[model samples]
Target: MLCRILFAVAISLQRVEAVDPLVDVSYTRYQGTSLLNGITQWLGIRYAASPVGALRFQAPQDPPSDSSIQLANEHGLLCLATGASPMDNTTSEDCLFLDVYAPTNATSKSKLPVYFFIQGGAFNANSNANYNGSGLIKASGMNIVVVNFNYRVGPYGFLASKEVLAGGSVNNGLKDQRKALEWMQKYISRFGGDPQHVTMGGDSAGAASIALHLTAYGGRDDGLFHATAAESQSFASMLNVEESQYQYNNLVIRTGCIDEEDTLACLRSLNVTFLQKNNFNTPSPGAQVAPIAMYNPVIDNDLIQDYTYRAFEQGKFLHLPAIFGDDTNEGTIFTPKNTSTIGQSDTFLQSQFPALTFEHLRTINSLYPVAEQYPNSGKFWRQVSNAYGEQRYICPGIFISNAHARDSVSCNWNYHWNVIDPVSAAAGYGVSHTVETSAIWGPENVNGGAPASYSTTNSATVPVAQAYWTSFIRSFNPNTHRLPGTPEWGAWTLDGYQRLLFQTNATAMETVPDDQKKRCAYLSSIGVAIKQ
Candidate 1:
């Protein structure tokens, strides 16, 4: 889910003597620069060929090599996003690019660990530009390389139908990520990154994408990543290829492709402007500010063989040591206020989970009573938040963590993020979605993230969270005493599961059990297992 009201800040570029950074992939040379804080950033590196023209709606293909030194010094053009405002207007179909941030002091022999992050936008919004891994490079104490990149999104990324399936390429966006990983495996050594030590991390849709990769091909070892970290990971029920045919046909109708001799060809031929303008990103009244994910990765036969929940139950995922968690009130922002009464909430629930039957809706309503049941507002918003948080973010976290813990993997830990920005607290959003996103990026660039008061909580959390993350990146487990006041992060266990509680307040190192165990169980029983 995208966070609200993030004013983008500009980073002033500094010119230093060309450290003469270079990467030669099959004779194609990329000359980058050591620009910020001694971290050599190689930007706009192509991981795959442009997914345009005949390549539209197809899996990512190998990037053709170049002869000259291609300068990877700028951010790649963003994938065309639906509903992007006119002010921050920058997008294109030629956005299959990745950016690498490495320590200048490091060499090809350094073999430093790599942290690859995917930006979150509910799979329809956001780009790699939202996150600059420069901060994370410094936060890792010059020991790790950070990578962020753009992937296809929305209709271009994921729009399913018989035509889409028959085209022999579905979930192209996921494939784009896979291909990027493969590229890093073959080429990151030139950039001082360890391919075998790559740790994948992200928030929201990015995290969800990681989960799909974990289960891709029924746990086949692709050797793409070694460890994973996720915040507010989604367990949203995914639609099968055929199940998304209605949406696909609807998109065809909306885009004037329905009457074409070759509707798929018509879709393929449409320009970025036309396609971005015509999309499935219409916000549902149900998700409030958050999107309902009309376009997302589906259970395509290749990448995703079966339901993710069923896959997890059957141990059909690459079991790795992971750190995953959710915020305290993850659902508040997604829970719309217009849903007040039980009937209205039921209506909203039906819209959000269209597959749910009336009985399922009734069960959900019973599980989450109206706000009258709470102390303050006599509306169902907070109740809705509680239910949605447990169902989507919190419970899926528990389920996935438990799945990892049950395996022989060591130090699979979970955490609860309760640290709300003072601005967000005053506005009643609580520690909402993507609150830790900036913190995960680390404390190098400071603006718009810290609270006004700048309490001890603020001072400690910034680096403390960084320590937990960097430790995990350096080593699979986050158990660290590097940062002052940071707690001993314990692993999730079948005997006694525990999660670290992260708060802006002091001594918040408290280990707690799953917060909403019963509610999560109820959700699982009702088959509200994953979000599409």
Candidate 2:
């Protein structure tokens, strides 16, 4: 009798294992895979109709209706990029998919907080594949859900001209991000994610994307996301659409559509391969050796009406709780080498922002004069790196943090990521841009192995970083669920300028130094000349 009861229990366990992890949204069923790590993931789920043929260059459209049970086992193709990318071979114009990861035992009624991330590649090359959520799911103790998706990039996404704007659209990439957010609001509950409690986060260009959304449509609160976390945010020049017409004209001429009645229609009608081949053939006049980003967000007077600096100055942004900061040396990677002379450094700056006059350059040089004690990659490399980093990444982060503290009723948290890596320090990229990403996402998910110390000598930093980030995602405040023995992270206030310093075994709250504050103030004073 005891042997028979054991056999019955074994059969019951087998039956439980046979059930498939599936979800239904808007009549479409998705068969997901249950990872061995206790997380259930639905990959390559379509969020919008394919933007091909007539839909090319237009805003994202609703996905077509389907009742079939589609397999969500592998990632979809990445969106076509403007230049060489890590994974360009697997790209297509039809890419508009998102991935979702949740606890295996979660039900529709679980209503766990959602963390939606956007990947960055200078608004050109990169995809959601770089960020796998399995580790983050485990880090959260299988309590929260994680999501990431792809969007259009390059000329296909940011092309701006009267003809293109009138006939098709502009900023389609930003629109693509919006479409994915709308999809989450509509269907995340099926994956046990609470749409109403979503936290949007990103790094580099991804962080810049979040800043645009915060000020999009004149700070319109669309009820899409509740809070934000950004690292190395950038606020590039916001030129008028007409200023970029030269690039649009060059593209149309190269594609043999300049003579056509409607250039946008002609370009869209061409085959994807022919267009992709021609996308990189034409280069703007005096385009730098390490070329400046030509295709950028424009002043459309609709989605993006003005510069991000001006928008924040006018208090025109969502007053949501936020965690924003930058690395100690953001410009190390962006500044070009072999700039042995001050002339070369000045040329580089001019190439980045053409609107800067001689006087503006002089002011920038005076503000960031070469320091005697600074390390050298070039004669004036450190000076140029400091200037470029402040103009692009560092100041922009401070701008957002100050704006949040001054305008928002909700608390704002900021950090300075200075955790040193032996490999990076040896390579001269001291706490470079996006260096802390692996820690936030868990070192295991990084494409190549993460820094050796992340898993060995400095292993303790990983859990601490994850705890603060996930804590913010789960609750609006980061202090609520932080790990034991960690320092209390204080909110950023206008008077204090307090921010947390995230370092290995030495994390603590610190104040922004007075000198850096003066530099940021000078940059803000010349916002219009730089077009930021």
Q: How many residue pairs clash in model 2? A: 0
Model 1 misplaced regions, further than 4 Å:
1-19, 85-88, 127-130, 282-291, 371-378, 443-457, 505-515, 528-532
Against the true structure, candidate 1 reaches a TM-score of 0.89
Score each candidate by Cα lDDT. Answer: 0.73, 0.81
Model 2 lDDT per residue over 363-478, tens place: 88898887323345676776788888888888778878888778854468889998999887776667788878889988888776478778876778899999888877777677
Q: Which residue pairs come into collision in candidate 1?
A: 43-72, 235-530, 235-531, 236-530, 236-531, 237-530, 237-531
**Candidate 2 Cα misplacement greater than 4 A, ranges:** 1-20, 85-87, 127-130, 281-290, 371-376
Per-model TM against the reference: 0.89, 0.92
On a 0 to 100 scale, what is the lDDT of residue 32 in model 2?
Answer: 97
Cα RMSD, model 2? 7.5
Candidate 1 lDDT over 1-532, as tens digits, reads 0000110100111222323487787847787887757888888888999888999888898888678889877778888675664234467787898988888877776777789887777777763354667777777677788888899888778878889888748888888888889989998877877797888998888888888889999889979998899988876657788877876777788889889988898888886566666664543333332246677788877779877677776788987768889888888777775556776665555556666677777777787765423333437777777787777778778778888877765658888887757776666667888677767675434335544433444656766788788877876667542476566777787666678887764524444444367677667666534243
Worst lDDT run of 10 residues, candidate 2, spans 10-19
